[model samples]
Target chain A: MTNKTPLVELRNMSIAFGGVRAVDDVSVDLYAGEVVGLLGHNGAGKSTLIKMLSGAYGADSGEIFINGEKAKIRNPRDARRYNIETIYQTLALADNLDAASNLFLGRELVTSLGFVDDDAMEAEMRKIMTRLNPNFQKFHEPVSALSGGQRQSVAIARAVYFDAKILIMDEPTAALGPQETQMVSELIKKLKAEGIGIFLISHDIHDVMTLCDRASVMKNGKLVGTVDVDTVTDDELLSMIILGKHPHQKEA
Target chain B: MSTPTTNRSAKTFFNKLGIDLRLLGMIGALVILCVMFDLITGGRFLTPRNLFNLSVQTASVAVMATGMVFVIVTRNIDLSVGSMLGFIGMTVGALQVYYFPDIVGLGHWSIWILASIAAIIMGACLGAVQGWVVGYLTVPAFIVTLGGLLIYRGAMWWVTQGQTVAPLDPTFRLLGGGADGTLGETLSWGGGVVSSLVAVGLILASRRRKANHGFTVKPMWAEGILIALAAGLVLGYVYIMNSYTIAKGALPRIAEARGIELTEGLTLYHGVAIPVIILLVVTIGMTLISTRTRFGRYVYATGGNPEAAELSGINTRMLTVKVFALMGALTGIAAIIASARLGAVDVGLGTLDELRVIAAAVIGGTALAGGFGTIYGAVIGALIMQTLQSGMASVGVDAPLQSIVVGLVLVFAVYIDIVYRRKTGA
Candidate 1:
């Protein structure tokens, strides 16, 4: 990797909830302009590790670095200050609100008169929607009336609108059909082109192989290894997660 | 293309109209009851004088019902409004006789406004306390407000010593009864005509604004017909008032009958009741706040999903407190109106008023689950309840029967709401 400063780096981070070490002494470096897949079994602490990065949980020990600067992310608001945004499995879009309103949920654009600037918001929403996914046309309709993929787009748009540099997506394509999954994958690629580093957490090996640049496996709250996606097959990544050993190490 | 557009527009019109159809059905039932009673009473039920009295009688409950809509929309209820009203009314009465007469050296009008403000503030404080418990402390609103019902009522009894306060100043009495003296009096004709026109105009302007803002407006024809019907009703009322006769000064003349001298023929109240006017103004103001403001949006969001709203950085806790405060302010306003109309206050001034207000909101089409309702619907609901009560009373229906009928109507209204929700998949 040519970039000297990793966009995000975790050093010996650990969190315990009532004596259960959900994540223990896990460290990883995520560079800018890359998609890193975090994969594990259901209780392997992959979610806990990513949650710590996204500020949903506080680490018990160790540290998190953003652009080589040590950071304290006590809450979601603090994580947002460091341009870290998470799109949970539920998407968290206000279903009753339209796309423009959902896009600026927490921080809405307001006019000089101190009212929401509907016109400017609608225009910006249109531009973003067209750029990210041309098929998205329901601008005025509430997100509740939208398809699953479209709702995901609204959530992603919200994060991207705030200029998120480190994006965490939890199972973005889990409940979606192939077409919708493709739509989201394309959006991820667009985000990647824009130099946004993404942590794609998923159990779907095909999704990781097709979309992620590097795959990281975790088992029992510990990092097994990180491997380039191009050089490793889905079977090798599966074995790494299950057996907790690198394929190259086994070959050697 | 034109055919498809027209078809789509027609469908949209029906969808929007469906919301108000329940209200229309209630109004229709009221009209039928009026017609039936008019025939039974030899045309007395439809008289200009009786109609005018009905409007005044419904105003207090209608005003409180409007505020109740806000609470109901958030999936909360304020069961203490009745007791709160009684407490506020007694306080205002005491203030007028004691404080206003002594320290302030104020006349009736000044005392009325000041007392109203005091009542509103007191109500708001009380509401905030309850809201804090429900919203911040995460207590169930039902339990909190139910407790408020008992607490406020007890306070009222203790404050007034269970006595009926009376002999309010003549000016205060005029505010309640002076307007319709003889049906043709200038106050009745002028105030009624002007206010009705203003109401119609405001409704039209709002509908137009919604359309211009890219919101779906009801069908133009439906709106036009509604306006025409309202205008016709007002004009018809004016004509009836013009034709009524009463003795002004030993000689018989056509004038609106006053409530105090109904024997001289149909004299309208000498002027519009102050309470009625206040009710209209507050209803319109609250409706606007709910439909066209940022705070209103937050109310809906908080009710819909509190967690999502908080994650979006909205101050849900503050919004909840503010809503309760607003409800409190409304209760105060209603108390003042009730006190003015009765010319006194007692510990029981607002007895059972809370149940009626909550029932009015539910009957008016507001969902008990929150996130969907309107002040106008609530007012209409209150009117329906009051109208049913008044209509049944005129026919000598017993109190138990009235209760039974009201309960059945409430159940039916809720059933309709559930079915509509299921149909729309909302």
Candidate 2:
């Protein structure tokens, strides 16, 4: 891979929630337009690290740099200003709102009269969906009626709608079927082509190997290491997470 | 896809009969009551004047009920609306007595404007305090607003010393009554002409806009029929007003009174009052806000899932506070109307008004759990309640019986809502 300045650099970031150090001294670099898979077991601090980037939690120590500049993200609003968006495992979509409405959510497209311009929003949503996920067509219906993959699309659309450059996806395809998983994989590829950095946290090595350009492993709130996906196998990454050491590094 | 298809089919069926079934059921009950009363009283209960009286009578509560929809939709109850109304009305009343004479020696429109602004601001401040407690401090909305109810009403008691303050300026009286008279005034010929034209234009414009937006507009035939019916109602009202004699040969019929008396014809009570008009305008404005605005979307989203909304970068607490503040302001407006109607402000001005407003909203199909309601629905709900109360009183029904009937109706409405929700699984 060509060397480029990382889009997001988390340096020695630590977050503790009531005596529990969810993320401790984790430093990670995410490049522009790259998919970096974060592999970890349950409570391995991957989610907490991502949450810090998404402004769900404030870092107790260390710093977060966006586009090579030190950033202070106090809340989700600040995170959005830094073009960092997160889609949690729950997706955080309003079920009653339709796809177009949910995509705009709090920041809706309004007409000159200050009323929500549903037509303009629908048109924009159609364009985005067509470009990203062609299979997603339920526009008028609420997101609650959408399939798992479609709901994920809506969540992604919401982040992307706000011009999010760095996306933190928390197990986006955790509960999807085979077809849905494929759809999400294709969506990830599209996002990569759009030059948006994605930090994908998942337990599925197959997904990481199939979708990620690089994979990072974390164990017990500490980073094991980052490795190129092309040079490693699923078993190698699994061993990295479980054993907390690279096979080659041990020999070295 | 298959599930939604089947669900849509079921929804269509329900729409055919059960859509607005609450309103229909209420109307049916009202008709039954009228028939029973007519049978018992030998048709005195079936008079046109009584029906007209019912419309004017239910106006204030109906207005407050519309505001209550906003409060209830957010899954919060505003028990303080009634008290806020009393407080604002008394404030306005006190301003007319004390503040107005000291400033411009009364009879100035600016004084009324200032008084209204002061009352509304005071109500909003009170509401903001409650909203801050409920939204920021995480206090329960019910307890906060309930405390608000007691505190505001107590303030009202202290302000007026538990006595009725009256002799309100004529301008204030016009707010409750009309420009010309009391509560029985039907539209004059000129008013009838203007109202009919405005109604038709509004209906057509709305239909066209809906169609342009790809929304299903009601059939043109249905719209035309509705417009025709409205015109007929206006014409009939004009006829009734022209024919009625206030006092035998009280004055000579003037030029304006020839076709349909403008000056000496029917009193202002013969037509829609200013307060009724205010209620309609507020209801329409609020309905538009709820259905069309970005803030309205946030209101729905915040109620639907607070965590999701917050995660989506919405200021959920701020929206809650804004809504609560709006409810308070509306309550103040309602207080002004109520005070005008009663011609005085006292401690009992807004007592039990909150219960009535809440019951109206609940009966109108707003869930106490939040995220599902409309201002129109709430108004209809209030009208149903008011109709029941007025009709019962006309039949000489006792207060205890009235209470029992209202409570039963509330339970029945809620039960229907639960069953409908279960059946639809929405």
List TM-scores for all candidates, in order. Answer: 0.82, 0.87
lDDT (tens digit, per residue) of candidate 1 on B263-285: 53534332344555666688878
- Work out how many backbone clashes candidate 1 has: 31
The number of the candidate with the highest TM-score is 2
What digit string (tens of lDDT, one per residue) describes model 2 on residues A52-137? 88887788998989878899987788898888888889998877678988888867888898999777788789888987688888
* lDDT at A180, model 1: 74
Q: Report the C-alpha lDDT of model 2 over B40-155, residue by residue, as the tens digit.
A: 76777656556545655666777778767777777788888888788788878888877787888767767667766777787778788888899899898999988888888888
Off by over 4 Å in 2: A1-3, A130-138, A243-252, B1-48, B178-269
Each candidate structure's count of clashing pairs: 31, 11
- Whole-model lDDT values for every prediction: 0.77, 0.78
lDDT of 1 at A158: 81
